[model samples]
Target: MSRTSRTRLRLVGALTGALLAVVAADPAAQAHCDDPPTLADLAQRHGRYFGSATDNPELTDTAYTKILGSEFDMITPGNGMKWYATEPQQGVFDWTAGDAIVDLARAHHQKVRAHTLVWHSQLPGWLTGKEWTADALRAVLKKHIQTEVRHYRGKVYSWDVVNEAFNEDGTYRETVFYKTLGPGYIADALRWAHQADPKAKLYLNDYNIEAVGPKSDAYYGLAKELKAQGVPLDGVGLQAHLALQYGYPTTLEDNLRRFARLGLDTALTEVDVRMLLPATEEKLAQQADWYRDMTEACLAVRRCVGITIWDHNVG
Candidate 1:
């Protein structure tokens, strides 16, 4: 067999092992999975980290806290680090909520993946309610990226510098930044983020790119272009927010491998397998299989660094 075939077989075997391990898990240790290898343990065995998205309000629940601390070694703030949450008013910043989550991560010896320096959604009224020239908006965006990224500079493991910047058809979404600054906004956001936190890995995150299609192709082209220009683009985050009805992205592992070939680290940034109402046991088992498959895919790739479930409590 060729080297490629051997690697493929190894990946398949790893996936099968993961599934069997899940199937054999003791029911009594289901909450924390004390008997089976936790996701973090499995990831660590492959020199990767496992993480989950979380919010401040959920931090107050003891049960939630215990599971989060025990099951994962990294945390992504679901909202507290977004543009609106970090900078509620222009020229003013608030780190209260984001800091709280960071504190929690530190206490648990978990690294934080500070999410989202620039996104079209969750914009504060101060910036969105007004109109401005391209130059003015550029300044605002730079300051926001610099301030937020600098604040969490050393504390974060990575930053989703630009989130969902592309449409499903492989076109750039005409968000305020894109309209004002053109596609250059992506490169600029990445540069500013690197300036602020030189050590933190920067990523462009999006959904529906788990498969080899137009959307994933767009990211591939952009990543190559960014690398050519010496941009500090470090990774691509595939938000695998899948649904059972849609079936699995069969090309997920291949997609990740292609991105890794660009000398970029790949991660499942936000993963959840949702189903229609009244989810049956069959659906639940399917979801579990997907979880195992995703984990296996990440472990299979050398440049695939980690996996982060969207949030802890999603069904």
Candidate 2:
């Protein structure tokens, strides 16, 4: 099955099993940690930096609380708390889901990472006007960032101020944000986010930039330029979505090193080793090796702060 289908099945299972709490409190030997090199142990050994994405209704469940308490120092609410879930209407902002996530993180003394203050994806219909000129669109964007960031001020440890602005070939994707506000929109978004919460660390997040290639070079160059231009970008987030089949990039260390040379903190966000279709024993072993390499790479980098998987279980 595809990842989407797998995700749907998991969601259904989660909803049904919401009441069935896992009795085991052994955070070091949980389902995802059954392997020898548990993510919990790896994180504790590397840095005190470990995190996970969760959206269960029982935010304070035994299993979750146990794992989070022992293993995770940071927590991201996956997609349960983003623009669409928080603000479905134009000016009517709802803080139900996101606020719950913040509260849970705070309760556990975990650092909260707020994703995607500005992105072309998951935008509400009200903000999708084709007629709005650049100036008008700028006004809307500013309000969106300011309102949301200010509300979560002092709460969020880092915010993905801008996400996936560049294509795989070192060029800006023709996103609505780009079309209306031009490439400057990224810098503008960072500035706006900084103004909203000066203390919050702002990051630029993108996928497929884990290796030193055209896409990686594009992100690195942009980050260097942003730093030079005095943009308030605090970190660079590498969304490490790896596969267990073909092979993950072995050049991840070089990639992280290059980003670190730019004097910015790095994070391995949204990591997962997918093997949804049939899997052989060799494939599973390869998957384990993939996870090991990623962990080792992140651990090696002094500037690499944390590594978070997108979803704990793909299928």
Candidate 3:
């Protein structure tokens, strides 16, 4: 599933034309890529960083590595830092996968956006295997969040403190954390992450929140509340995982603006314009249009810090 669920390349415009530019501000800073100016170069001009989500296995492929190293300036470990990968046992922890990707990013002169700290999916059996009282669960949660964030401190740019907390209808998802710790767990997670790494930005990342809708509304309300309480919430990640069949989020720009209004950074994280199989040229053109529109929307907003393509697939 990890390999097949690949987020294939969706370039800025036509795949053939410019392929996007990446010249340094001084043109004397030295070129990272031999020719094409990467999306990272283009985004840097606007004080932003473009990046992608990569896995440990793919680093060996030179073809993919070329783009992974040059096309973007940020790297997201798609699953490396998740609960399962980070903590396979009740008290034990692992950093092999997470460290590999972060090392790759640093080698390429890129910043790291740690994929997530608290999430409902891909949890290790030791965590999801048993039931727990509220207090016990809270302790476990805090320990896990602080442990991981602390380990990656000063290395990562941000952490997806809590991911996909709200559902499509603006209601909370009934995950283990929500079931045991309640909605306040989200706030607690953010605060704990901040304590672990005061310099790192903390974000709530989710898909399908790119537009003005119930899901985004839930985030906006929660972000406002967190700020009023002086919680350490710093950003909102709109995962912008759009499909051609569902149509683009027409209110995307306004949605970004609203988050920025609340004094929080916004990013088009996990961007991928997907379509059904046997895609025609016409469909690909429209797909490119979707990519272009999303890119322009992020660039138009000041607080929309950067964009991260989910990663490219050549297989």
Q: What is the C-alpha RMSD of each candidate to the true structure, in Å?
A: 7.8, 7.2, 3.2
Which tens-of-lDDT digit does each residue in 1-315 have in candidate 1? 001100111123344466345434646434544566655665666678888788898888888788789878899898899988989988899999999999999999999888888899989999889887999999999999998998898998999999999999999998999988899999999999999989999999998999999999999999999999999999999988888899899999999999988899999888777778696778767777777788878767889898877766521
Clashes of each: 0, 0, 2
> 291 in model 1: Cα distance from truth in Å?
1.0
What lDDT tens digits, residue by residue, belong to model 3 across residues 1-315?
143345555554442222242233346534554666666776776688888888888889999998788777899998899989999998899999999998898899899999899989899998888999999999999999999999999999999999999999999999999999889999999989999999999999998899898999999999999999999988999988888889899999999999999999999888887788788998888888787788778867899999887878665
Residue 308 in model 3: lDDT: 82
- As for lDDT, the candidate ahead, 2 or 3, is 3
Estimate, for each residue in 140-215, the C-alpha lDDT of model 2 and write its tens digit: 8888889999989998898988888888898999888898789999999999999999999899998888888998
Rank ordering of all candidates by lDDT, starting from the highest: 3, 1, 2
Residue 140 displacement (Å), model 3? 0.5
> Which sections of candidate 1 miss by over 4 Å?
1-37
User: Pairing residues by index, what is the TM-score of model 3?
Assistant: 0.92
Off by over 4 Å in 3: 1-35
Clashes in model 2: which pairs?
none
User: What value does the lDDT take at residue 35 in candidate 3?
Assistant: 61
